[model samples]
Target: MSGAFMGPPWQMDWVDTARAARDSLPRRVRDLIDAVRAELVTVEDPYFRGVDNLPDLPEGCRISPLLSTVPSGLHVCHFDHGRGWIHYTFLRRTADPQIVVEEVFWQ
Candidate 1:
């Protein structure tokens, strides 16, 4: 957030909106989001979740790629709150085709 890009790592501007939307969701939906996200990160590969090895991603709760390039992995996140898809551009720091996940614990 300190940098000019002001996002995860790719500097996608919509990152702020994404977080805000998540924060404002109902408790039930927010909990569902946590559960789904937990499954996603545990999986080996997120970009190509094969039909055989797909996560428990529900409708209106999927993350799709908008742009995938070196040093930049852009994605479109959707949160269905009955209105429509609240889309936001997001990304993570990756080395080549491999995504680097950094674990953080909060009490």
Candidate 2:
């Protein structure tokens, strides 16, 4: 998300992680995530579920890093609509590693 990157303390690790994650995803999923990330950048309020909603995430979901240095704070999200599941992993900071998902499947 562009907005997430702009303003305040800029974190270079996020950019690096986002780029690497983008490159690692399957083509179709990668495209979807690109659009979502762009939307998140422009829209003031992006759709996001809290850790508590991890069980409701769509299926086919996977976790991609968005910040290497703060691995538990930023992530690119993917969901599988058929299964109603979502998957993501982010770092709260360099010290905190968090994994939030609606299901246990990740590939």
Candidate 3:
């Protein structure tokens, strides 16, 4: 069996808010979410690969670990919407077999 479960991160309200505002969000923002969601379906090694940790992040996306904002393995990524970048956090646990999307910063 696959040891991977993709769902909402820690702060679901934030993610929910994003979904609620999807229509108003920029194309790149929507694309970022769509791409992330798609890649998560078949979670494997290099967990964040193709989603955040990729080769030459598509012009608008930038994923980096938020040293102090989260724990050791958590990360914060940015997806640009032409003018600015939307930040969000996620968790990838080695033993849990679960990927949690913590929160998103639209502003």
| C-alpha positional error of residue 22 in candidate 3 after TM-score superposition, expressed in Å | 4.6
Count of backbone clashes for each model? Answer: 0, 16, 2
lDDT of 3 by residue, 9-69 (tens): 3222245654556546777667776665444434343234544546444556655566655
Find the candidate with the highest lDDT and give its number. 3
Point out where model 2 deviates above 4 Å.
1-15, 47-78, 82-106
Q: How well does each candidate superpose onto the true structure, as a TM-score? A: 0.47, 0.35, 0.47
Instruction: Summarize candidate 1's per-residue lDDT along 1-107 as a digit string, tens digits.
Output: 33342222122132455556666777766676566455455555555545687667666555566555621344443444333243332233442222322221111
The lDDT for every candidate, in the order shown, is 0.45, 0.40, 0.49
TM-score for predicted model 3 compared with the true structure: 0.47
In TM-score terms, candidate 2 sits at 0.35
What is the lDDT, from 0 to 100, of the residue 63 in candidate 1?
57
Candidate 3, which segments miss by more than 4 Å at Cα?
A: 1-15, 21-24, 40-57, 68-71, 81-96
The model with the greater lDDT, 1 or 3, is 3
Candidate with more favorable, higher lDDT: 2 or 3: 3
The better candidate by TM-score, 2 or 3, is 3
